[model samples]
Target: MRLLGIDYGDKYTGLAISDAKPSLAVAKDIVYGKTRQDLSKYMQEIITQEGIDVVVVGMPLGLDGQPTQQTKKTAKFVEWLRTVLSVPVEVMDERMTTGAFRAEHKGSARPQRDDAQAARILLQNYIDRHYDNHR
Candidate 1:
């Protein structure tokens, strides 16, 4: 089953996809949109083209595992996405994936699209924790 991972943001969103075996995740693209409606449209197109069976959205939680404002917003966006898409949507904790990515790429002047990379981390985390368990 193919899976799409999302790192939701206010201005820019990150996207990643799982491989055909649904074992590995890779960065796909970054989507820029003004509103959730616009983001949903872009996501729908990718989902259709990639034949995504599931969507794993990264939930931004506080260090204490508490829900942050962004977490609530992402939840709403996920709810909207669920209404439009036919695939199952799930949320995975994404606390420090971005920080980890940055730390790994420290001292680099190159533009690292952290959002997409974080999405890849989020997706891979989900696949390792959830899909692997099922298998």
Candidate 2:
């Protein structure tokens, strides 16, 4: 099954997709300047086009594992997605996902792509953790 991963942000949203076997996840794209309704519609299109069976959204929790304001916003976005999409939607902790990507790149000038890379890392972690169990 293919899985789609999302890093939800206020202004920009990053997207990633898993392979057909779902063993690997890669950066897909970044979406911006869309209303929530429009975004959901766009996601539905992506789901259909990419044959996504599941969606995993990154939940931005505090380092203490407590919900932060951004967590609340992410939850709302996830809820919205769940309501609109036919596939199952799940959440995974995304603490330090962006930082990890940034640290790896270090001096790279591709700040705009950080969100997509972060989503890639987040999805890769999820795949690594669950792929074995599912197999």
Candidate 3:
């Protein structure tokens, strides 16, 4: 089953997908901003197009492991996501993911790497917890 990873942002949302093994989640594309109501529709398209069996969205926790405002926003998004998506949606801790991306990948490739790498980090964490360590 394919699992999709998401890095939610204000203007845009970064999207990634796991391979059939649910590993190696790669950033597929970005979903541009639309009206609040339209965001669900846009996400539905990605879910269908990628044949995603599940979703793993980034939860932006604070450095102290507390929920930031953005984390609350993301929680709202996840609640909304469940209605639009046919598959299950999971939230993965995304603290410092973007920061890590910026640190590792800086340059012309920065923009793409920022979101993409974050999704990878989120999905990889899920994969490790779900399968890698267990197996």
Q: Which candidate number maximizes TM-score?
A: 2
Task: Give lDDT tens digits, candidate 1, residues 23-105.
Answer: 89999998876577777777788889999999999999999999989989988988888898778899889999898778878
Candidate 2: lDDT over CA atoms?
0.91
lDDT by residue for model 3 (1-135), tens: 888888988887777788887656676776676665776676678778878788889999889999989899999989988887788998988887777768776564666436767787778778777865334
TM-score, model 3 to reference = 0.85
lDDT of 2 by residue, 1-89 (tens): 99999999998999999999878899998998789998889889999999999999999999999999999999988988888898999
Looking at model 3, report the run of 10 residues with the lowest lDDT sum.
105-114
The TM-score obtained by model 2 is 0.93
Clashes within 3 Å, all models in order: 0, 0, 0
Error of 3 at 78 (Å): 0.7
Between candidates 1 and 2, the one scoring higher on lDDT is: 2
In terms of lDDT, the poorest run of 10 residues in model 1 is 104-113
Each model's C-alpha lDDT?
Answer: 0.87, 0.91, 0.79
TM-score of each: 0.91, 0.93, 0.85
